[model samples]
Target chain A: MTYVSPPPEARSRGWYKRNEIAVTPFLFLIPAVLFFAIYVIIPIGQSFWISFHEWDGLGDKTWVGTANYERLLFDDRKFTTSFWNNIKWLVLYLLAIPGGLFIALFLNQTVTGIRLYKSLFFFPFVISQVVVGLVFSWFYLPREGLLNAILAVFGAGPVNILGDPSTATYGIIAAGLWPQTAYCMILYLTGLNAVDPEQVEAARLDGAKGWRMLWYVILPQLRPATFIAFVVTIIGALRSFDLISVMTNGGPFGSTRVLSFYMFEESLSEFGFRMGYGAAIAVVLFFIMLGFIVYFLWSMWRDEKGAR
Target chain B: MQSIFKASVAALALGAVAAPAFAESHTLSGDLRIISDMSNPAPRAVMEGLAADFGAMHPELNVELTIVDREAWKTQIRNALGANPPDVVNWYAANRMAPYVSAGLFEDITDMYENGDLTGLDSVKGALTIDGRQWGVPYTYYQWGVYYREDIFNELGLTEPTTFDEEIANCQVILDSGRKCYTIGTKFLWTAGGWFDYMNMRTNGFDFHMQLARGEVEWTDPRVRETFANWRKLIDMGAFIDDHQSYSWQEALNFMIDGEAAAYLMGNFAVAPLREAGLSDDQIDFYQFPMIADVPQGEDAPTDTFHIPSGAENKEAARAFLQFVTSPDVQTEINSGDGLGQLPVNANSGVDADEFLEQGFEMLTTNAEGGVAQFFDRDFPAEMASVGMEGLQEFMVFPDNLDDILERLEDARQRIYE
Candidate 1:
């Protein structure tokens, strides 16, 4: 740090003037730091604290030690089902990345009305997730859905996609993917624009083409976009609450409950008042997310060092 | 013209509210904040009217009415009451209030009840009281029963069933006639809870039904099984509409409207919407759910109530507001055909002359010999009800899974009650 000598006007201002340069940046940082501590850091700490209690949200919180966590891990079938559903969501949701890349590649063309085609493909992301859930809810309707309508033309089903426990989770994920894939496609489209055509041409001259060209040259350049897509997808899968809430309400007998939705159902929803259990669920979800967060920070750090 | 008519109605209602207030010995002169859950079009009007008239009665008192959506208020009430508590709030009766009452969020209004300040409320006082002390006052309640197609019944030459055999015979006839006997949607799941309330009550009588609700009885108790056995008979007969799990209670009404189903076991609120949906009074009629055994005939009548938070700033005004709202005249006016179109909790108040309301009032007053129960979800603890309703829905869909469902509920009951 550089030492700043007191100016003539500040010479008689004591230690305050002597330390102005050193303290000015901290004064500027206080607002953001305060907000972050209050909103994010403090709540994370509070969640961990609350998890060890038996609170019904209205009453005084009773410290139950690790009982909430024990019940959540061992005895609660709903939690088990929700955890498995989260796994299903995580694995299935990653399909969007590849799906987006293919669509981005297909749309990376010089044709008439290509922009129109791209926008049409990008249309789902423009609308809200709630709308997507509703449209897909009707699409999977047992008797009068578009899915059944199309299937009937081929002498097949009247399948109740959202009604059956076995297929309801898949149906919701498919709806979520509609918009999520669009998001990834846009990310990749921007990445493809800055994809360094000179490198692509150089690879083509070396006889690299098609899938090989994509793997060796295109994908390497789209690393930033892929990185963003992977992180967002993971977070989206972990926080898969809204679509499930809007569509099934974690139902046909709690078959579609993920951890985020389950936490809400156990704490704040009409029947839920077990706040300690909910906080325990939240703490578990936070730890799960923390693993990815640490990985992201480490990767960023490595990348920064490489740049240096 | 519409605005003019609305103004006249408002003036008339406000006039009624104002007349009694002039008799109050002292004037209230502080901000009285209220959080109401009467967010429906008709109920919202009644709430706003109540707040306005209260403000009018106490000219110096600033009355604030914040109307939250009825469903959202269920979860929001705890936060609302636990924090900067309002002077008054809307909530449901029975175990639905247990959380707030036990948490000391609600004011104990027992002295008001004992002092004879709220007259003719003793009949529903049982609902407002927990541990021998009154906590709140009920403004309105509605009866739940089989709302059948009178036109269909007449066409098929069938009478309202009065016993288990007769009900089964009637349902078989309806099914044979190429229509379902009942339309129910377990999508939101409480509609199924209503069915369970009636079935369990009628089979084992109200006391045992209440014991089951209180978690004192096992889900696998043979007597509880007896109730399910009766429920299973109907399921096995395909007596309910197909894909009932997909529709909501409101959506299920389409079956009756289209003559695809013959009846719906629902609350009195369904009457208003049925009329709105183009079903005339002649097309629909009410009947209590038929007897499944020789038990006293219990009925499901869920009461909606109001309470003052414990930390209310203007409690004097809040107590006066509760008394004013539950007054016989006010109850009669608010529960009129033009208002909530339901039964008034003030026993002295006459119900609206609406046909369905009259029938429901009669049924709940004289015919409910076993007891009047707050519907299942309201009677049982909230956690148990949530898990229980889901199991009930699953049971309706898969009758063979009864053992598994019962085991799950028994486990939940043990854990929750402990």
Candidate 2:
């Protein structure tokens, strides 16, 4: 190859190209940033803006200045019910993580048709949550449902699970947990595959066995999966709208309502679209979710620093 | 083809001499979009066929009809009407359309009626009128009545109850015979409103019911309390099925169909489901809700309406389509036979020979002088209706909480109306 030493412009172009690395990443990121801004970020800001106004969606917005928040916090009984229901959902929904870990551990061993067993275990998560909700709703039907039929055989229940105000939220949450548990199981299964076999062998040689071996060694290795499962399950619980919508529509006198469903109902024009009020509800929900997200980021950052 | 060619040549010659007249009769060409909630198989098929028939009649016009699921339609309608609205939209007749109309989301097509292009909708015109102006053209409505199992009634030596006492006694007898007197499902919430409407209208009379629906009367009014008290009687007698709140309206009908429950207070649309459940015509029967205190017997006949959105781009085409839909022929086709099984609003529309429809027509026409209510949910503002229906459901589950429920409903009513 001949060296073209006389080309000064080419040498300068090389300098510019060396600096282009930083700009190239940003250029590649622009499409995603634009989409995220348009679909997610801007709507969030708009919801915050709408929360301060009294607008019926189609009409001119009147600035009401914290009136919606005041009503939500003080006046609305439905809002209070929905807020408590959301808390109940969050608390109950956390059970999926451990339940999933147990299932993943049970199915992690190699055996005949192990792959088929794993796939079948993941089946509920594969279907849409809407479908899961519908199936669970049919299963919980007071008279003609599978659960009631089984209960009838034992002379126990013709219990109206989704009908009674006391049990409706728990019933929906249980339905939600089915798919959520499957999702966690899949996450843990992948995490288990990536576990270092050498570490397990070393721990076994040290006389560690069963629960202690798994808890101290295996679980520590699966931190990333556990973190992901926690984040997703928390978000899943907070944003549970479709299941409640499909199952009860926040019925049996609005006993099963969660915050998301309440926000939707408030802003639905069919229910007279109190847009400002709905936006207020959304802002409260956003703050709640933000608390979890911030906590997650803080913990992740701490873990990252500790690892380094 | 030859006749068409000859007619075109003659039309071309005549168009030159009478350009204005030709233009007047010429179908305006544009995309006329209609959004409907006729999502059920029978109604959806009828609506689609009607759109095709209308498109055939007007060759220049391109009709686009979007049928959406009923629940989805409720959330979608605001966006559908607020932004780039479809030319025509289907909605409930009265109070349900009021919010849209007040927000100027719907166009005033009163001219269509005055211009003689639309006629013979006197029965339902009142529902579409607000503040001395017509806002929509109603196409279909159905009667709400007590549908009972005739075989069960015959076996119990019972007849149709005409008075409140007789009805309570009949319910007592049905309970004694180990059957539910009424079956209702409140899982969707609106089903409870049907019971409330009949009780209110029967006790307080139609005018008071309308006033209450409009929020002119407080929910805690003595008359309103009486309505709840009467409803309490049914609950006390164990008239309704156990675990009524767990089922949808369709699922609740299973109790009636299986002979566990004797009667259901529902619309005429429920007949198809009953028949599909294998009930023969003779096995089913209808009766007006029993009189409570000798007040004029009002009937709930919720009418379905169509209106042109104010933001619609093709108003002329939309108006023409509305007129086409309300024509006697189209009305007859939509209302009669196995389509929607609803009553045609147009007086000139041909009647169906179905016994249930005949009974509904007779009952509705006779009670016409008293007034025809557009059920509780339809007659009240959406916000008020939501709150009111919630209260009704709460009452169903806890009849002893009537006082608190009414107070809460009054609070919601004041908040909404103000």
Candidate 3:
């Protein structure tokens, strides 16, 4: 192979001059940066500050000095329930990733109208969560809903999907899973597009098949998609508020309250804004989220070092 | 160059001087966004008429009224106040205003109140006042009562019950006739609490209700237990609808509107919805809950009030609007806005409507005469309402667990008070 060097004029130039970058990129970045700071960063910092004080969002903020944190630890049952529910949500929600992968694989073939089938499978994720909550609520309605109607065919009585304390949260989580699983499927489909056909053929020749082949070969290649799916699912589980609000409003005796709903209930709902208490709940949630973020960053750093 | 500099300096001085004066002399000329949960025709008509009247009174201010559904309004009010609060907005009385007042989020209307700028000041000023400072004015007053169907009662040969037992007997008669006695929705859960509040108030009077609301009285207090016992009797008799847990208040109203349900124990605000469905006043009647008849008199019956946001740009204009609303003429105009026939805040305004409103007016005035107390939600605080509503709902469904429910409510109260 022959190698050619750059012209002397190009080689002579410094890094800044060679780039010739315009201000347009900075212009494009400005709006996004501004939005991020305004909506995300500032509110986060404000919530953290609020966690330290007793505020109702209206009155003079009393300097509570971690009193809220203390109360959340010892006094607030809703906080404990909300935190535990979030954990349940995170653990069960991850099932969507694998469920989505299976569906994607099954529908990956280039058959007639496979695209339409894929889209149809993805339709739940396309709708807003509010609509999904309404649909699921109707589906789970005690006597008149689809689930009950189906149960009636089997000669079973109506199930109180949203009324019973034990099953209400689980039912809502199931509703959440429907859309989340579809989202994971989309991610896997994209990842499968770039899979090496040659490698798969060689693996098949070597007698690797089904679960074993998938575990060793295809799964490893799909790690990036899986990672993204896990990350979003975790965040979704932690911030699960809208669906719970729409589906049940933490009802049937606060059985469905997640951390986000609990926080809002304390600070904003008919429950007078104990902003400090709400912030304390937020602080606890923040630490939990931070653990995952730190682990993710550390893993990335370790991978970079290994590559070097 | 000297002349040019002088001219520029003079123009700058004139601009500075003219700006505030221009702002002051102008009538409410810009957008007056009024955010309310008053979506029904009666309040909406009144609100629209107020805009027209205000426009006629002062042409500069253009009122832009935006009515949100009840739940949506709470979220909107918080966001709006946190960012850009409207000039005039709707709010509840007492502790509801306390949060906003303490934070300096509302304009102080003490000056206007003291100056007699708002007529009928004695009637509504209390609702808007916190710690002696006036915050907002009430456009209308409402009474909580049992709205029953006169046609059904007459058809069944029943008179309005005078005592708690009589009320129970009345329900029994309706039930024996294979009719559902009462309608309620526990879907949002608070609707159940309203029933509990009325029962407790009637059984133990305002002081006990206040004590319970404040968490001073245990939910299992004998008085409180009595309220539950009373509720249990009704529940045992199947007084309420079968599937109330799944119904919203509006959905329950559908039962009354269609004559499927005989009675609704609800606030006076409910009348407009019933009337809108083409039900005549002759078909509907109101009465105080029979529970309170045995108890001693209490302070002022609770009232819903509104406030001026602190960050409002048109503070003076808002003050003027509040004053105008409380005036006798405007109060009458507001009452007649859409046949809402709400009890006027002005004690002197007196009821001049058909019999339903007249009876409501008489009850409210008698309450005013007796004295007033903040409603349970307002008196106790928000945290209390949360656990309280839950306990009420639980008790409604599981009367056997009254002790456990009351104990939980007490625990919630203890934490909140601490």
Candidate 4:
């Protein structure tokens, strides 16, 4: 009576119920895993497959082995230009982080209507990139734009910012940095808000102040925000397409083209769909991004292990 | 129930016997989809109105029109015509439609031409024909020429240029007067093709331009270099507005309208924007791009066309829509509408009362003594055109690099055409 054995099915069901702790988390992960595979993982594999073939978006696919990659590496000058521009974008876009930190520090105080001031400072991040691009294009307009007008006031003649090959990419990058800087500012602002007051007081007691106090005391606490800002800024810079598209359209003889815009122009432009070549470009970009992702994951893993 | 069944069978047999005789008058009913690049408000509204009118005439048919932005439509059209194809789609005549035709994405609509008056559509019909069969029905076409400021000319006491030398002299006069001779926007790349079309056609004439666009001639050929040489003369004369690469065609018009530039080489569609900017017919006028090398003037009059997709679910309904689109009444309505500002392809469709329209027609028919050439980008394969236009843009930006640009274009041509 105390321990009567149940039927085999009922006994197995009880065993399953007892092991729910081991299985429930995986069950919860199924939906996310499925979506990730469908949207991200599957497309990446398909892009790799497409890179081996010469296919217009509409017609039959013909396998051409590594011809697309060969063309990209050796034959295509536009590809080289785009790769260089992407590198430049990656390097220059990092300025947003310190720029944001400067602004966040300037507005970190709790004065009256400080909330309004913070929102105003964060306004650029809220506007659409397309609108930002248009604003920047108009800003750089050769004769009548704001930049030219401002120059004229100082007895300096107008300079074409977006029309010249030398300056066009920088002009677009400057546009991208406006919103990126605002984004970094908000992240830093939140990080600053979470800073421990007791630590600041302790540092003050030790006569630490200004650069010394901030570097020795505050920066260590802001690491998490800095990590996130760095990750996003890198991704943002790498995917800089909308601004270039709207502002210069990779013009001034295709000098402003980044990898993303070039890929689009190659495969989906009025130039006729070179799906194979576009896929090859995408594959190259994927590997470059994968390198960053692996480093990021490895670093994060190390940090987690250290924290434990 | 049995008696009723027998009666129905008898009725069916009788209906089948008479079906053939009544087939010509049968009303077609289905959803017709037309994907068009009429994103501008005026053309979009005009197309919408025409669709509504067509729908009204055939109550059984439903017309679903999708008007997409021009640049977006270029990409989307491939998908639209490649898979789940629309019943009808808008495209340019001649070489622009050639790829789709070769891909068998568009239907053979030669029968539609036989059913309509083909007189007025002779030029465009020739353009839309491939393998001696018509593939599309052109609805509208407009001439491209130098739209100049009449008031500026009168003020400077400068006469209209008739020869290449006179045009160059005119440019000098404008330059001396501290004004630019032309304003062109090369940002979209295709705008540069307009200048190339004018230069090539003026230098070597129509046949050569067509051959070059078709990739039959080497881009590095001496004759081609001469065309570039002539264009270099214009560039060296300071003919164009500064920083043209940053502006779109619409943006470049600002210079022309603001009196900073004296003229623009553009299609008739530009007239609406110019008019909107407060220029009247009296203030502005059209002139053929002047003669160069004494070759026949091969004018660029790009024709807008519509065609049924091969994968259309309802061919009959699509054909009806095409017929409606090309009908003189509908053509007249479209041309007269404020949006298109183009001439109708139907000969019976009377010309608009507007002076510019009248003059454009006269110049295209009587003055363009050589023949009509589709715009450079339209007349060439998209891949070749893209490379060609890029070379043209590079030349415009750095004329000293003409040889390098030409060589690069030649490389692309051999690769693409191979």
Which candidate number maximizes TM-score? 1
Model 1 ranges off by over 4 Å: A1-29, B1-14, B17-24
- State which candidate, 1 or 4, has the greater lDDT: 1
Q: How well does candidate 4 score on lDDT at residue B326?
A: 72
Docking class of 3: acceptable
Candidate 3 vs. true structure, TM-score:
0.84
For residue A172, give model 3's deviation from the true position in Å: 0.6
TM-score of each: 0.94, 0.91, 0.84, 0.92
Candidate lDDT scores, in order, read 0.90, 0.87, 0.76, 0.86
- Candidate scoring better on DockQ of 2 and 4: 4
What's the residue-level lDDT of A176 in candidate 3?
Answer: 95
The better-scoring model by DockQ among 2 and 3 is: 2
Candidate 3 deviates by what RMSD?
9.9
CAPRI-style quality class for the chain A–B interface of candidate 2 = medium
The Cα error of candidate 2 at residue A150, in Å, is 2.8
The alpha-carbon lDDT assigned to residue A242 of candidate 3 equals 94
